[model samples]
Target: MIDYQSGYILRPVNQVFIYFSLFCALMLNLLPIDNYSWVPDWLIICIVFWNIHQHRHVSVILAFGLGLLMDVHNSELLGLHGFSYSLVAYLAISWHRRILPLGLLTQALHLLPLFLMVSLFPVLTHWILSGEMYWSALSAALQALIEALLWPLATVILLAPQRRPIHVDHNRPI
Candidate 1:
């Protein structure tokens, strides 16, 4: 079990895990999906997980930085994703104590629309700013649908309890 002492930064291994997860999310975001990308935003999902699990350790500022990096990588309007992600992070952090203790199914169900709402706000902003009201609202709705569906799986996989290691004498090997 990891002992997170008060105000202690994450251990090296944990830091690496966080960085790796974020990097994977970035790669997923950058994946070429042709003209129509059906993928949900992986980084947001990871951010949600981290904030839920360790809000004290990770803050809205981290989410903002990641979101800004994502926008720069994708060449989207600067600060757009940053603002949206920071908002989401704040929501998650504020609700962390309440939400993190719930059962997985309940948590997922509860957070589905919350995630959708966060995602939709940015999309709406993007659409209005770009003056490209071309895509129907259904398109954004569908993306949120996919994201909602994936959230439970993401939480389970990322936060699943790992088996503990056992000690055995080498001489006892069969």
Candidate 2:
């Protein structure tokens, strides 16, 4: 169990698990799902989850690096995902303390705007550059909606190890 009064202390192994999860999410995001491809923003979801729960471990630089990698993988305009993800990381870290005390549903509600910002920033940038709004922006909004709906499940899966009961050797000397 975590010592809440002293703050959560993550072991080295836990840190590796978190990064490994993010890698898996990146691979999952790269899958070819046809029209349903936009249904899940796996990388953004993972980044947001970690930033909120373990902000000290997940930094905005890491988020920006992952976003750059995502842009390369998707053949998108470079720096688009980087900027959006960094923004999401910043917002998540900013609001984490307030959101931490809320129920899962309420937390998801609060994150909706952040997720929308993450999804729409690239589209808005493109519109500004081209002077035309693409209908594809609607898909980003739908993706945000899906992500918000799935936030609770993501939290449960990602944070499960942290919530596990720790075995203390009481016989050991203090």
Candidate 3:
């Protein structure tokens, strides 16, 4: 087995895992959660997590593409989710270094405003276009709360593989 000077081995994250996780998140977003249609935004959560932790792997272009897919899936305005997700990607990338050292709860707190903005922008745009405020502040708050609560779990599950060191066989002939 390969030994590490730091006493911990870390496996390189594969591109396939990243894409697969994103796909899973998209599928989760499409799932119908009974009467609670306002389930926390799974796609956004996954995007935000990757943006902060694996910024190099997830880019603005990818975010835009995923957003467009989400828009098509949800039958909403074509660019709405795309714009929101790209904005989140930008914000997360900008603040990633600063947010990385903080505890999970702290990171979630830092992300609350971004989550709120994500939930609000479309509502505001729709309101302006339709001249009716169909948005509910309480619903937005609940969604943000749920997202924050799920952040830790997302990190643990999504990042767990990356945290474990790969076992290399030193005895194998190259």
Candidate 4:
């Protein structure tokens, strides 16, 4: 392939794997830990990654539903996560082609803003509505920075199953 991601050809990603990964990420996010601003939203990050790599399987509706589930689980305002997640999905899906061809760290840098938006949008909206604004800017930045820094690692792990070669036929042409 003229523009392959790596030396080995990635296998066709199964729908089941995509959903299972997303589910695992969701479960991780749902753990009852004290809400920390520095903690990255794994669900949103996974959703964004899947949106970029497997948009056909992972769509905005899925993101919206996942966000709503998170909102309910966290006992926060309704539709806040839903709206932000869907927005991120739309942005990812629309720009995925451009993003896919870039280097890993550059991809992280490009996506940093999207992560920041997801981190801050709900908090900012809630603050504005309830009129209790605080220093969320720093927290959102921290969360986004952490997530962005992990993007390359996330990609490596997530893509491993697809990248592993089933058979190496030296005689066969790629």
Candidate 5:
């Protein structure tokens, strides 16, 4: 086993894992949730995971890239989601070292509000840019609530490290 003191280097395996995780996050973001979709912002959730675990390597740049990709894929205003995500990434990375040491459940709880703020900011921007806010505030509030409730479970699933195969020889050990 590699020492935990391995610092923050992104090994080749880690790079692959991070990029794969980002792709999965993008797909999840594209998945159509109904009008009252309970699903949270998957890309933000993924960003939080990466920020917590790999702060040194994956910073705001990755968040901006992912957000820009999302904007293109969804045909959103060029920098709407990108700007919001970049701010969130900056905040998450700022506290990452302190935050990651907390228990997973606690970390998720603390992160919930921050995620909501990030999501809501974009919605408000979209409203302003379009010159009319049509969505129901009550409904958005409810969705944010649901997202907060779902965060802990999602955090665990996202942050769980991939298990590597172990070699064993039954005959060698008397």
Candidate 6:
């Protein structure tokens, strides 16, 4: 079992797995079910995870591109998700050095603010621009809560493939 404490090194994440997770997030958003108010944004979560864990492979530009697809997915104004996702990517990249050192629950709690902002950005902008709210305040809050809770779960599942196996080998030293 991999240690949850500090100083435990994870194997390098595969680039293909990173892209696959992002793709799956997009597909989840594209499912035929009607978009619900409380559903968490899988794309945002995945983007944040990869941004924090593998910043070099996943950058702000890619987040913007993914956001564009999300914009189309939700039938929202163009560049809304793009801008928000780009902001998320930028923020995650900026805070990654700090976030990587923290424990799972702490990391999730720290992300709550960012989750709120990403969930509310478009709603706030829409209200400002057209004097209407696309997302109700309660729903946004719920979504943020769900995403925050999912952070720890997402971290574990996404990092599973990258975890190093524990073995007793005196001759081999890390």
Find the candidate with the highest lDDT and give its number. 4
Give the alpha carbon lDDT tens digit for every residue of 78-136 in model 6: 99999999998999999988887789899999999989989888878888999976544
**TM-score (C-alpha, index-matched) for candidate 5:** 0.74
> Model 2, 30-52: lDDT tens per residue?
88765452577889999998898
Model 6: runs farther than 4 Å from truth?
A: 1-6, 134-138, 169-174
TM-score for each predicted model, relative to the true structure: 0.76, 0.85, 0.84, 0.91, 0.74, 0.91
Best by TM-score: 4
lDDT of 3 by residue, 10-83 (tens): 46777799989999999988886642525898889999988987889999889999999988877779999899
- Judged by whole-model lDDT over C-alpha atoms, candidate 2 comes out at 0.84
In model 1, which runs have C-alpha deviations exceeding 4 angstroms?
A: 1-13, 35-37, 130-132, 161-174
| Cα error of candidate 2 at position 166, Å | 11
lDDT of 3 at 84: 93
Separately for all candidates shown, the number of backbone clashes (residues 3 or more apart, or on different chains) is 0, 1, 1, 0, 0, 0
Q: State the lDDT of candidate 4 residue by residue for 1-174, as single tens digits.
A: 112456666778988999999999999998888788777899988999999988989999999999999999988799999999999999999999999889899999999999999888977887889898787455777888999999998998888777756677788775
Cα distance off (Å), candidate 2, residue 52: 0.7
lDDT for each residue of candidate 1 in 76-99, tens digit (9 for 90 to 100): 789988988898889888887777
TM-score of 2: 0.85
lDDT, candidate 4, at 56: 89
> Candidate 2: misplaced stretches above 4 Å?
1-13, 35-38, 165-174
Q: Which stretches of candidate 5 lie over 4 Å from their true place?
A: 1-13, 135-138, 162-174
Evaluate model 6: give its lDDT: 0.87
Regarding lDDT, does 1 or 6 come out ahead?
6
Q: Return the TM-score for candidate 3, rounded to 2 decimals.
A: 0.84
Which ten residues in a row are the worst by lDDT in model 5? Answer: 1-10
Task: Tell me which residue pairs clash in candidate 5.
Answer: none
Question: For each candidate, what is the lDDT?
Answer: 0.70, 0.84, 0.81, 0.88, 0.69, 0.87
Candidate 5 lDDT over residue span 5-45, tens digit each? 22222223367777788788888888776545366677787
